[model samples]
Target: MVQHVWSVNELGEWLAAVRIDPAIFDLRPDYCAGLMVVAGISSGPSDTDSDQWLQAADSCDIDLDDVHLEHWRDAYRSFGAKPNRTRPSADALSRRAEKNGLPRINKITDTYNAISVLQRIPIGVENLDAFVGPARLVRADGTEQFDTTNDGLGVAEHPEPGEPVWRDDTGVTCRRWNWRQTPRTAITDTTANALFIVDALGPDAHQRAAVAIDTLRTALATGTPSATRYIDTAD
Candidate 1:
């Protein structure tokens, strides 16, 4: 049994403040692909895991290059940013995994990566304990401090003006909508509580989001047997 459930009122409040209207879909899937989250687990990827990652990457290569992806990319670009320069995290990960192999950041992270590639949608996960307060997704004013790494060195950056971001009281958790995640709330081996946000676009967005979330819930349960999962859609 899972313990500790946070109120989602803050998420609700943030959505109300955003300019872009997204179709939110709450989901609960029966089983997630064998992803697990346990304390002290190694975050390395094995050769076999790498092979599987490559296989999943291969499956999405064509879709990623075709017009299917452009629909959503165009929607994101409509927000005044170049999708290629600031492509959605899921698309970036899929492309990178296919071209250079996936980074094994532990089972939990890898699981989501696989899902993102297969589903072709952006997904964000955070260590709940790192948050200062309730989480919100709002437009960036270019002032929030984003702690991240560049060239193996830790650095601080700011989101572009008018960009959509996920934030808490401390700082921005995700920048450029779902293009990148800040290190401040990144999930790690020691992370116990996690929150996931899945992004979708286009006409069938709600259905796509539902399928992605269900896959996520199942994967999360595989790692944390006591994990409790839930979903909240926008009204």
Candidate 2:
């Protein structure tokens, strides 16, 4: 896999350093487990994998009213943002898959989505070829351009000031701490190099994020040569 420079910026450093709501361990710090891999996309999920996806969706039934999830949601709220407005992608996908069937995107995207639902962690994947790194996690200055779609028409927007986002030299790669990804780095069937970011909360974040990353890495390795690297401020 290709090696890309990744880092947390000054704001990210501050967020990682501060302690918030001592009663809630998830609010203590920001820890992310990131993996960069080079792989070919599969046409689609197999019948067996589709069945596993459904099983994973069923397993998350309890999350519909899970207090732990509420606490996790609250942790994000402490950052001065609304959870519903900036809900982690994993939380949204899990809820949607639990209600409707998971949308089949592609092998790489679907694989990470399945793992996200099963592990209950936010996983963000981006096409490395579309980026001009070094990749960084920082608070947005409200000037970074975000290319997205609205009502099937293309739209370009800017991130809110102080919003947590991942960016490259060009513009915002991901906004709202994984709520939305820009089209510039969206993974498609032709994407050959990609980056997977697993974000976790709570006291067991390190262990949980590690497991999620390893699971995805192992899954991808079965089809192609894959490599992984970890990023954790707590360490």
Best by TM-score: 2
TM-score of 1: 0.72
TM-score of each: 0.72, 0.77
C-alpha lDDT values of all predictions: 0.61, 0.66
| Candidate 2 CA-lDDT value | 0.66
* Stretches of model 1 off by over 4 angstroms after superposition: 1-54, 58-61, 66-68, 222-235
Pick the lDDT winner.
Answer: 2
- True-vs-predicted CA distance for residue 108, candidate 2, Å: 1.4
Cα displacement (angstroms), candidate 2, residue 109, comes to 1.4
